[model samples]
Each structure stands twice: as structure tokens, then as C-alpha cells.
Target: MEQILDLETDRENQTAGPSGRMHLGGNDLTVDAGRVVLDGTVVGYLYENGFLRSAREQTEDDEDPDTGQWRLVDDLEGCDFQGTTQDGLPLSLPGPSSPGPTGSLSYNGRDYQVMQGRISNAQHKILGEYYGGGRFVLRDARTNTERRSLDEGSVINFSFAGTASDGRDLSEQYTRPLYRDQISYHENEIIRYFQDFDRLDQQQRDYVIESMRIWAASGILQIVRKKEGNAALGNVKHGAAGVTRVRTGMVDLDAEEFERDIDLCARFGPLAVITTRVPSYVEVRVNLVVSHEFGHQLQFCLSQAAQDRIDELYQARLARSIAKFPPPSAYDGGSELVHADQVMHREFISGYAKASVFEYWAESVAAFSFKESRKLLRQLDPGIFSILEQVVFTPEKVMSAVLCEQILNLQASLRFGGEFGKNLLD
Candidate 1:
């Protein structure tokens, strides 16, 4: 097995192992400008968060016939640094910079050689450059300067700096590996936004909209209700139907508890699942309240795993409730839960709810939409032969008794006793 090591806490100066530098205990080394520090010798496989930082070595001058200009000779043997953007966009390096001639390089399987040339950005044309052996050309459209050289791969690292694209000056800082794409934002902006928001009265609908956006920036989804004609609700898809606000909440209900909450609200999926903060009068800062609402949106968009427990509870309840029905009767070839491929998803059908699994499961899970609950009921009582036929149709062949038995067992586990079942039925 390959050994793993942390350079931050590991002791340095120890005899090197197969993993390269055994370990190092440096007091959080700070890199200054133009300083290169090696964490450990480049060994088997080295990974760094940033890019390699290095100074470009000056190349000797060579004469180009087309431009009749003296230019730096291309050196492929030297190491080069490569940096990637935030979304991993790779920018071309070794291209011409301003005030220089254009160049190209040819790769002969193992080596790369440079072809000298120049291009004019204004004219948008290559002046004069012939390729003898080099295959690739990198041109900086801005500056005519370029180089052609032989290819020799060398180790490189990641590095970067931070400044807003809007031309705001940022404090200069360097992190290794040098080629890493790091971004920094002004901290003062966040502080200012927060202070201004806290002082607002929640009664104003516009304040709720602004607050929701701010909360979203902080990764919180907030539910807010605006009085009328608020711009916040104008552009959102499905913004109407009297359901003004839906946001992700901030509270961290334990995984088990979250499952229980979902079961309780199985009937109100459309409504925002929130903390106990709503009041008849609007007075709180809209942003803070909206943060909780946004969380519900996030919860609604959860993966199947997020509700695995509730799904399991539903399955168990189905099985137990089936035990009460005789074989080849109401329980035998019933709803999709027993027949169709039932994978956990937000959509709830009928039949399953009336069977008793849904009632207890609904209460256990938190806020559910009545629409979903009613849909579950519609499935349970198909009303006529047409709906019943839909449920029992064997799109595939016959369902083995084993499959029915397995499902029944699952339902039994989810069945609730006494008052819990009564509350759901009521």
C-alpha cells in the first residue's frame, strides 16, 4: 500500500522513505515573492493545491530572417509553469507576449524545435515564419513576441493572486504550488451587507427579496412572503399560485430526525419547511428569515439517499399492513409500491397512503403537501376497474411470491402502532 503523509504536522529532517521526503514539521512556512521552497523531493507522485512558482531564465538572442529582428532563442529544455482557471480552464502558456516577435515550435516525436516568425495584431496577419520541423504554434494576439523551441518536459507548479475583475486592488499574496487558481473577495463587503440587512424591518416585501438574495449568497435558502408586486417573485419559474416563498433552512436536524420530519410533512412538500419563526406581523430582517426558507428548497431537491430512511419506513409499513389483508385480495396485486418499480423520489402516488404506510410515514416525515397526500389516496382507492387494472397490469411477467414476501416484510417494519396510525387516518 502507498503510504500517505501530511507535511504540516509530520517531522522533517528524518531519513527519507520510499514516499520521498519522510515527513516535515515546518512552522507553516510563508513564501515571499520570488522565493521557491520545496516541500519534499519530487518523488513517486506529488500533488499540490497551487501552481509552481519560478522565474523565467533569459534566453540568448537569435536572428530571424523574415522580420530581420533579433529575438530571444526558444529553449524547450527549461521548465515551465501552467495554471488552470477556477472551472479548470487551461490557458495557453509559452505564447507571444506584447512587444515580441511571433514564434512556432515543431515536435519530432521526442524533441521540439522553434521556427522564428512575427505577426501584427492590428493587421491580424502573420508576417513571415516558415516551419521546418516544429508542429505547434502559440501566438499571443496582443504582443507580436514569440519563440520556437524543442520540446523537453519539466516539472511545474501552481500559483496565483486575487483581485476583482472590476479593477479593485487586492493585497498581493503567493501560495504554492505556484500554478493554483485562487480567488479572494473583499471581506468588508460581506460585513457591510450583513449590518445593513439586520437593521431592516421584515414588514417590507422588498426587504424580504433583497434578504433572500443575500442569504442565497451565503448558501442559505430562505422563504419570504412579499405583499404584492415584489420584483423577487417576478422572474422565478413557477412563481405564482399563492406560494410566494420557499427557501433552504439553516437548522441541522440530525439525519434520523430529518427523516422523521420529512415523514411528518409528506403531505406539504410544496410549502416551505421552516423553523418556528413566522409571525402575523413582519418585523425581522428579511434576509435572515429568508435564509431559513431557502433551505426548504434545497431539501426538496435532495438526492434519493436523503430520504432513504423514510422510504425504508414506508416499505416496512406497507409490509406490516399487508399482513392484515388476506392473500390474493386487497394486499396481493395492489399499488405500485407492491407492483411497479418503486425507487424513492419526491413524487408520491395514491393507494400507498390509504394502506397505512403513508399515514405513519407522513407524520414521521415533516411538512408534506396535501396534494401529495391526496395523490397517495387516489392510488389506494382506484374508484373503478380501470384504475385497478392499471395497478395490476403485469407489464413484465408474473411477480414471484418471494418478491411479494420481501415487500411485505419491509412494510411491517414501517407500520406504526395505536395513536400514530390513528392520527394519520384522521
Candidate 2:
């Protein structure tokens, strides 16, 4: 673990960590002229948030041969921090001022190197200067001033999780990426934008983060800028924005993937009714892909021992439920998975859930994690809802206790019971 160096908290002279110095307090950490100061050093600058809107890094001398313009660096914030207009078109702002970003990024076999860069609002380009094999420095993109940088100590991989999903503990399966992706962001405009977002009405932005950070922690969603496309692909190709591997907790949601589906997800409103673009026979595919993928990761992290017990519990519960109420003698024999409004909906959240026990558990797990999805599941089948609540979630804790706790918290706002009980709350 990188020791959090503090002037008062530490006994010895401290060394800067990969993130350098950090000023952390809940809503009290103020920014002046875009920098965060801790102890006496300016750690990192802040970005201003506003309406937004992409591009590359260039040096002072690096010029576009054809256009005769410097190759403009991608304003990571402008591409990231966005909003929508009253007419519902994308609104890209150019105001938030920021120093740079701190999180690590993984890419195709190599981590991008971090380097000192210049950001100029005048030229609209970030000029990074990285030496061949020496240490890197970061600078304010606007003023061309070198800023302090933090060094990371270690990237911890989980050690004790009982065992692996397969036969043995596949501890060696996922090797943490050592290489770093070197990039910088514009400071002045982006920093100003971020500092002002809390003051602006959320509806003003294209996406308001009421619970996005909390929600995304499920699989540790890390969006990377590898390539741009309408679909997401990594670890394997899925024509979607996000992919979660059962073997490893590493998840990737392409920026384009979120961009493509968010509007559709919003269309369902309050309910966020899922509608799929997968061209399947099922009438709709919910925008619960994030929730769905999180389910897969949670289940994947479980040891074989834990999985066996979960299956045993589900089977026993299935037998009891079948005795109380029989399955339809006539099978719908549908090709794609489906969710219906009728009760006793074939002991599955949807036709998709019926494909297999794993799929059934995953679909219900999503319902277990989300609000609108859970509502739909309960309306479709109370028994299955109970099953998801008890069997799967109970086992899920063995893998990710924190994630399960979050789901529990997220669902706390909802109330449910029998018909009269439901009316009582309303």
C-alpha cells in the first residue's frame, strides 16, 4: 500500500506516492487557481465542469505537415464531461480548467507512459515532453509550468478469496499491468468546469451522476480510451460498451459504449425499462448491461466450494417451489430470453434467464442490484425474487462483500410485500 504521507500524520520524512500529494476532505477541500495543495506542495489541479464535448498530444515543434497546425491533444475532459441541450442534442463545453488525471490505465500489452506536457488554451493543444528512459514530469497544460507528480508504490492483487472458480486458485491468471499509459489533460477550462458542476442543476448536464460512482464500483468499472466505436470489446468481443470477465474482476466499458446506450437507457425513464438492440426475438433488452455484467463478475469470483453450496440451495428451493406450484406443461420454446408481466413466469426473470442456471442467476442478480429491474422482476414473479434475494446474494458475499453491501444499500429505498402491504406504504 502506498503510505499516505502527511506532515502531521507521519513520523518520518515522507516520500511522494504515484498520485503525489492529495488534499482530501468531504466538500471542504477548496481549489484556488486550479491547484490542490497538501502540506505545502501543489499536488494536482482541478477541472471546472460545464457543458461539454476529443483529439491527441503534440510537442511545441510537432506540427501537422498537411494542415500546418499542431496536432491537438485530446481534451480528456471535453470528451468525458458532457451535457445535453434543451432540445436534447449533445452539448460540449470548453471551460473546465484541470491540471491532469491520476488513475492508471491498461492497454494492449503496454501501459502508456506518463510525461511532462504543455497545455495551451491559445493553441488548443497539450505538448508532452518525455525523455527516452528517464523519470517523467507533469506540467500545467495552459501555462507550460512543471507541476509536482506523485509516484505509485504498488498495485495490489487480492490474495485471500478462498479459491478460484475453476479447479484451483487461478491466482496467476491475471497479472497486473506494469506499463503505464502516459497522457495529460487541459487544466484551466476543465478545472473550472469541474469546480462549478455541483453548483449547476444536474439536469443541465448530459449525464448526472446521482449514483454512477457507487453503481460502477460493482466490477470496478475502468473506462479506457483505446479505440472509438459504437460497441465495446476487450478480453473478448461483445458488441456492447462494457465487458466483465468472470475469471478476473477487471472490467472495461468503452467510452463509446456508454455514449451509444445512455440515451436509450434514459428513454425508459424512472423505470429504465430495458430494450435491447441485439436484434433478438425478445421484444426488449433492458439497459441493465452494467448490472448484468457485474452479476457475472460477482458469480465468477466465487470459489468452487461456494458455488456448489449456492447451486444446492437453488435446487432445493426449486423443488419446494415446484411442489407448491407446477410449471407450465406447454413450453413457450422461445429462441431468445424474455421477461413477461405475468406471475410464475417460468421461474426465470426473462426468457434469457431460462437459457441456463448461470444465466438465470445472472439476470436475477441484476434485478437484485437495480431498482427498476428489481421492480419488474418482482411483478413478474415473487418467488424468483425471493430466490435471488436469498440464494445468490448470500453466496455473492463470499466473493465481494463490499459490492453486496452496496447493492443492499442501493435497494434500501424500495419497499415491497404482499398487495395490501404494498398499499400500506403508498
Counted clashes in each candidate structure:
98, 57
lDDT of each: 0.25, 0.32
TM-score of each: 0.20, 0.32
Q: Residue by residue across 22-47, what tens digits does model 1's lDDT show?
A: 11133222222112234532222111
Candidate 1: segments with Cα more than 4 A from true spot: 1-289, 310-426
- Candidate 2 lDDT at 105 equals 21
What are the per-residue Cα lDDT tens digits for candidate 2 across 271-333? Answer: 232433432213334444444544454455445655675566556645644554343444353
